[model samples]
Target: MTNGIRVSVVAPVYNAGPFLHAFVNSFLIQTLPGDSIELIAVNDGSTDDSAAILDDFAREHQNVHVIHQENSGWPGKPRNVGLAAARGDYVFFADPDDEFGGPEALERLADFADEHASDVVVPKMVPRGDRLYAQWRYETTQIDADLVTCFTTLTPQKLFRREFLLDQDIRFPEEKVRLEDGQFLSLAYLKASRVSILNGYDFYVIIHHPQQDHLSAKPVDPANYIGSVAVMAENVEKYCTDPDTGDRIINEIYFRKVLANFTNSRVATHSLERRQAWQRQQKWFIDRFITTSRFEKMDEIAQVRTDLARDGDLDAIVAYARAGSVDFTFVSARSKRGNIELAGKLSGGFSDGELPKLVVIDRNDKSRIVTIPIQLAKSQVTVQIPKETLPLMEGARRYDLWLSPGRGHQNRRIEGPDRPFSLHFTDDRDVELYSTKKGNLSIAVSRGMSTQARTKRKLKRIIGR
Candidate 1:
């Protein structure tokens, strides 16, 4: 029982002295009543002033409790200790370096969980500044799909009912496991009876700094990287029994996340020798878990990236990583003579000589290639989403933006910096631009104009001129 407490926030403190003030202050100032909230601060043998900070907070605030232990080198042990000591109805895991997004965040999350009797509550997490994550498309308060679909974000910040977690015995792996949050949360989703979400509001703020253990500037150890994936693979079978669902979670969810984060992006930054070692170690894990059919089911980019790593092709991985970070900005879109004309500029060291082509990747991951005209100026290109694509875009409500450099089958899918352009029928008369769920930058366009009407308007303006 929670003994009338509403929420318990667990934060693991190591060498986070620099960020402790902002982090602790945010929790203390929450809109939720101080007495109704319990703050479990675990001081994992921090070498800095973190222990003092936690002690001071515990002394001042009746709701705050400090637990000190020897350094475990990772967040898992501290989290498990905090969970065991938690007394609130719902438990929330917060990183010591990250701050609460707003005062109302805790209030909102607690209310939602209590009202719905939710076993799990997911609140929107916003990255500080221009940083981004692989965001989800949770349109409504409740996700229509399976909980496994929301596994893209494995951070353990969401609110989970204390009784539910205890009953299910969902605890983080102790001490030494990397990707422990992923392993713990995956099982949490599978076991949760009901899950609720708080959307369109920022509940948590993630601070990305170079010194953080998870986001260290140095290259990841190839053996440790492989070990993490192996643990996740083992847990997938341990938790999920349905053949299809387990396969999808392993192939579609876990594999994709690993490939995107480690293989495609982080590993590309490693030294050539390290990269080779990483690829070799990864193949062993991939061989045990990934089947040919499952690999084929992946999207083209994922398939290409995985195959390149498996085959020991470092050149393609390097090209893909560099090309993928190319910056493309949408300048303007107009319905020109029944064609959706789009113009954009490419920067971030991408040269027009690369022969970049704009591609509209639909929900099925099938792309409709649009021809790019010769640069009007250096690194600027104009292309059209032909009339045929309008129907596909209209149906899917979204389309990803990708640039393929050069021509032919050899062209690799290089993504842009911005979120994909979205289309929604604002009303019967017009199509509107809806940014992705993460609230990307607003794109301006003529409101209340359908494609047909916009085309007509463009033609009339041309004729009048």
Candidate 2:
């Protein structure tokens, strides 16, 4: 047994032989001393060589612990086993397919946890070939500000204080279910006293290979997906006493899950049979958990989808899913005097007679959707250059521009090499641009960007060119 371990990294392995070596080797090569960190790997009945590979590591490494169990068809049971065996000040749960972004990831997490005495520390979850998680915008955030805001991300791939987890009796659902990560995370966030974030470095590299047979890669199983949501909703009602918080969580957060995860996918890609069945299941869920008041509180698009789903209108749902399509063209980016101006063209179709508008959103501000006027056209829509749209570019992050059909409708973000764009502000106090060695886009800031925007005069005064 290992002693004085700073962190216990619990990874659940299931037929992940191809990536197991790389995944386990990441912990062995950590900048955090091998003796100071323990890797508790539970092999959940893999028919592949994953068991043999883990056994070899257990023999070779002093801090490696391996447990083999009959396949449970999910990572939940295996992770729970690993959690029981973990012996560290803090615990980290990881998937067998994903690896640490860097050698020092554990060291960094340990340092941050120790310094802040935090219950949870979320490092940047850098997905394969994509931007980092937008939710992680600051170095640290206290959950007291908005208990649901900081920890809404349901992924269990985070550093948790061992004592805090035990004290709260927080564990993943044993039933092999979809979106289980979010269910456990929501509960953890609501109960957590303190939550901090550590960015500026990649802590986790999530690999998405087509050949991978993970749950997400498989076909949509409506029963399991809705089951997962039901479990999470039950916990929310049980734990949360604040009526207002409960209402907001159910409407704002969980309602989005019902659409984005359950309804949207079923409508967009699944077969007609599957779509109808999924709708039937979701309708039951909606009637019970999702109140009429909550449905009314949803955004415009969400309300439309929910109504269509309730009515079982498959054709209308499909049309609504494909209603708005935008092709945005980035013209140029220039800071004028104290204003950061970005010019782009909006070309696409809008439904509900909704006009095209330039929308700028910050990574931190989830509620603020700023709309800028655009010039509409027959074949393709156009928007004037960075004129009075300066306010759109003001954010903690270099704002991501979206050509939205209407104020509350869905937005299509313009990405890729063609008609590219970037933002640079003279004032490095709140947000600035910097190039990373890995070539990922991130705005450099001395401090966290203000969640609330400054008045027009205050913004101009601070952003002198």
Candidate 2, residue 285: CA error in Å?
A: 2.8
Q: Write the per-residue lDDT of candidate 2 for residues 116-219, one digit (tens) a residue.
A: 77788877777774324554444454433355555356778889998888999988888867887878887787687777767778898877756778686677
Model 1 regions lying over 4 Å from their true place: 143-145, 209-218, 261-269, 319-354, 360-369, 373-402, 406-465
User: What are the lDDT scores of the predictions, listed in order?
Assistant: 0.70, 0.70
Q: Which segments of model 2 are wrong by more than 4 Å? A: 1-3, 130-132, 135-145, 261-268, 292-297, 326-401, 415-465
In angstroms, give how far residue 384 of model 1 lies from its true place: 9.1
Q: For residue 89, what is the lDDT in candidate 2?
A: 90
State the lDDT of candidate 1 residue by residue for 326-412, as single tens digits: 555666555656555666777643555665666555534455444444244655667765555545233323444456554212243
The TM-score obtained by model 1 is: 0.73
lDDT of 2 at 281: 74
The clash numbers for all candidates, in the given order, read 0, 1
